[model samples]
Target: MLAPKRSWIQQVVYLIGMYGQFLKVYVKTLVEYRADTLIAVIAGIVAQGSTLIFLTVIFNRIPTLAGWDFYELVFMFGLAATGRALNQTFFNAPFLLTGYIRNGRMDMMMVRPVGVLFQAIGYSQELNGVGQLITGFAIMGYSASHLDMAWTFLSVLYVGIALLCSAFIQFSILLTISVLTFWIQEVRSLIYPITWLYDFTRYPLQIFHPLLRGLLTYIIPYSLASFYPAAYLLRPEQYGWAVWGVPAAAMVIVMMAYFIWSQGLKRYSSVAG
Candidate 1:
């Protein structure tokens, strides 16, 4: 007889337990490479900081870009950074699936009792995420203090929901692209272009030409990751509907990614005999 299906809560608890074990293992490994972890975190901070400095220089030359002031732009950048940091921290290992596939490591994961995607995601940890997390929240805090929006319990709750949706969207995109390795077997270079697209999300969507704006919003939907949510937060009456799209788009992308990933698994061929 077939086993009973697990409830949603049971599934969530199982995932949490799996991730907790993964974290324990990751921490143990990280302790062995403390210097490397420190350097990685520092590098992340410097990289993100340089972007902020570049924005500062640009704002100094012009009061606003596409009608968004420095603080508003910072808020957008922070939202993108926070989403990216969450993906890099917890879901980035899937991007390395190409290496695993090429080396037959993926076969080992398939033989394990746990879910393959879960194992793949928990395969590694990134210390650089700590720096991005710090930088993202610092800019967000500074922007929040300066912005005219009224702070309320509901507003804070909205921010949390938006961030979660944004992070899911980012993770789904990364996973969908990474799953290409199941067929191509060498897609390491493809990740750069996908990540480069995210750079466009650091500014208001209005800055882009109409065609480019449409492409970002419809084709890749990068705008949903940060722009729409930031817009909603900055001016709820004006952009409240856009914020609702964030979770909707996130759900669609995640479902699509899962479909692709599941199909890709069927196409996977072991490199080992």
Candidate 2:
């Protein structure tokens, strides 16, 4: 006899349960190397904190960058950092797909009952991402309190939606780049340059050359993750359209990443073979 099919809600709950089990295993492993975990957390905090410090110095020297004040820039930086932190914490394992493919581990992953992406994420947890999350929210809270924008319930809702969508956008971009490993065979070198694109979202897009701005907005769409959302939040009258674009961009990028991953999966070859 055939088994009953699961409802969509049941499937989601089952997936969540699987992820929870993965998290428990990872935490057990993390506890075995407490010192290393502490060091990683500290390093993550310092790295993200230093960026805020550098921006503070820059703002002190110049009143504004393309008409955005220090607090406004901090808001943008915080949003970008928060999105990146979530990506690193949950989806960072995909970035190491090159190593997995080259080492024949992806073959093992493919044999698992669960989805390959979920298995990869479960195997590749970055505990230090907690530090980035802490720093990102601290800066975001401080900046939001200082900003002159009127605080309304809807405004809060908008920020919450924007942040969630931005995190998805960042994750999708990383996954799409990681998928290139299947064809390239070794793509570890591309990781840093791709991550460096986040720096563009830490400031007002207006400061960049028009062509570069177009690239960041269209080809890469990194600006949609932070800059556009920030613009919509701080000056809605001028950039309110971003309120719609942020979610749209997230959807488009995620679909694109999934398509790339599926295509790449067809090209995957086991290293052992």
Candidate 3:
């Protein structure tokens, strides 16, 4: 006899429960390895710390860069770090798709009842992102306190939503690049150059040349992940569009990524004979 099909809501609930189980096991493993977790956290802290030092040196020479004060720039840095950390923490498995495909692990996933992408996303979480999360939030809190802006509940909620949308944009981009592995079977070279674009988003968008600003705003939209959202919070009149635009862009990019992944999956071939 055939089994009954679940409704959409039921399926979503099932997936959430399954993901919870995955998290339980993942956390248990992390807890089992105290040294590894500590090292990963320290690495994240050091990485962000170096960026902070560089910013400090630049500010020491001048009061502001491109009309943005030191704390304002720090706020953007914190937003970027937080968004990147979220991507690393939850969606990092896409980076390993090349190996998974080459080793027939993807073939194994194909036979499972769960969706391939869901299983892949739940496969592992980056412990180092915990460190990044700490530093990012700490920096944001410190900078916010120093800034003259008022922080009400609504403002906090808006910032939280912006951060989630920023992370979504990044995850969509990474997943889109990873999907190329289905055809090329290796995407490290392509991914590196694209990821380098994110460096430009660490500073004020107004400072960059018009061409570079256009690239970040329209082509890759990395600025939506950091600069635009941060700017919307810091200077609402100047970047008011981001209030609607960031989430809209995230939805569009994620839809595009999913379509590409589906197409790539259809063309996927197994290495096994």
Candidate 4:
């Protein structure tokens, strides 16, 4: 068949750009609720700080994880935490799938000209993500500085790519879970599992056996989201294999998730008003 025109790709880019406008509107609305946003930021700081303290406790007790020393582990934690936090900050719309479907808000969004997937993500920014982002950056910076290893320009580049890949991978998984709403009337039950899976993405899979680790890398792909990339960055000699797989898998998953979501759109039956 003749290839479709370049129009489709352009439309997708246009859709993303439009979301930038919506982001501005979202920021305005958020600013209107200054107290709530402020409280959320402060609370997020405390919660995130507690998490770091817990990690410190664990690492202090354990000598090394999968032969990765403290600095290396910290690097892994930093990269994945930063990536996950950024994902939460930006593409948080998928989390609201339950309420949207239950209220038939899905029907209303489908009538719009823009991509409904993008539409579902409200134009407003997630202020709370900012706190997490700050925390993640702090940890990453601290870890990088304390390490005996020197990072060349290429290493820095790799870190940035790894971070982006991990975030995209996690978002793809979340997208896949949110689409499950169309299959089941209510899938709020799925949210806990989703969060649990995401939280589990922070560490090296080597903690588990080969078979179970394979399940994570293949079945749920938490490895692509965090574990593998973190390993590659932390212990390059040991996890050189995942340097490619981590980023490559994330890209592939994002594409596949997009395809799956498009399929779900076809199954959408607008609730008759």
Deviation in Å, model 2, residue 94 alpha carbon: 2.7
Query: Which 10-residue window of candidate 3 scores lowest in summed lDDT?
Result: 1-10
Off by over 4 Å in 2: 1-5, 27-33
Instruction: Supply candidate 2's per-residue lDDT for 136.
Output: 85
Best by TM-score: 3
Root-mean-square deviation of each candidate, in angstroms? 2.3, 2.4, 1.7, 3.6
lDDT of 3 by residue, 72-183 (tens): 9999999889888887787777777887888889999887888888888898587878788878888888888889887889779888888888777887787889899877
Q: How does candidate 2 fare on TM-score?
A: 0.90
Better of 2 and 3 by TM-score: 3
What are the per-residue Cα lDDT tens digits for candidate 2 across 1-273? 232478889878988998899889878867898887788778877987898899989978999889988999898888888877877777787677887877788888887666778778777777877778778888889899998889899988988888788777877887888888877766667867877888888888888899989988888888888888888888899997887878987898989888888898888877787
Per-residue error (Å), model 3, residue 204 = 0.7
Model 4 TM-score, all chains together: 0.86
lDDT of each: 0.82, 0.82, 0.86, 0.75
Over 1-273, each residue of candidate 1 has an lDDT whose tens digit, in order, gives 233478889878988998999899877866888897788778877887898899999988999998889999888899889878877877777677787887888888888766788888887567778678777888899888898989899888888888888777877887888888877856768877887798898888887899989988887787898889989988889898965677888899989989999999999877775
Q: Which ten residues in a row have the lowest lDDT in candidate 1?
A: 1-10
Candidate with best lDDT:
3
Clashing pairs in 2: none
lDDT of model number 2: 0.82
- Winner on TM-score (1 vs 4): 1
- Distance from true location, Cα of 214 in model 4, Å: 2.3
Segments of candidate 1 deviating more than 4 angstroms: 1-8, 29-32
